[model samples]
Target: VRTVVDLGGVTFMDSSGLGAIIATYRSAQDSNGWIRIAAPTEPVLRVMQIIGLDTIIDCYPSSEQALNAAEQ
Candidate 1:
């Protein structure tokens, strides 16, 4: 299974959001699934980078691309 999280509408994200994403990633891994972020706003992307999440999670330019990658 795969999950695509859309962050285009998000204006900002704090530690809580990062934590939630990490938890989801862990859960997906445990379930033999994958999780990716799609079109995150600049602010959110910056936060992810600061926390080193960008290197771990698959970040796509768009949700469609993420979904397609998950299928493969």
Candidate 2:
């Protein structure tokens, strides 16, 4: 199975959102699955970068890219 978090429409994100993503990531990892983050808005992207999530997370440039990754 695969999981994808589409962030294209999101305008902003706080620590709560970050927390939820991290929790979901952990859950997916534990279950032998993974999540791909897609199309984060500039604001959200900045936050992810600031917190170093960008490096560790599988963040895609677009939703299609993320989906393709899941298929592979």
What's each prediction's clash count?
0, 0
* Predicted candidate 2 versus true structure: per-residue lDDT over 1-72, tens digit per residue: 367899999999999999999998889888988888999999999999999998878899898999898888
Candidate 1 — which residues are off by over 4 angstroms? none
List candidate 2 segments past 4 Å from native.
none
* Cα-based lDDT at residue 52, candidate 1: 89
Q: Model 1, range 19-50, lDDT digits (tens) per residue?
A: 88999999999999989999999989998998
lDDT of each: 0.91, 0.90
Model 1: pairs clashing at backbone N, Cα or C within 3 Å: none
**Candidate 2 clashing pairs?**
none
**Candidate 1 global CA lDDT score:** 0.91
Candidate 2: Cα lDDT at 52: 96
lDDT of 2: 0.90
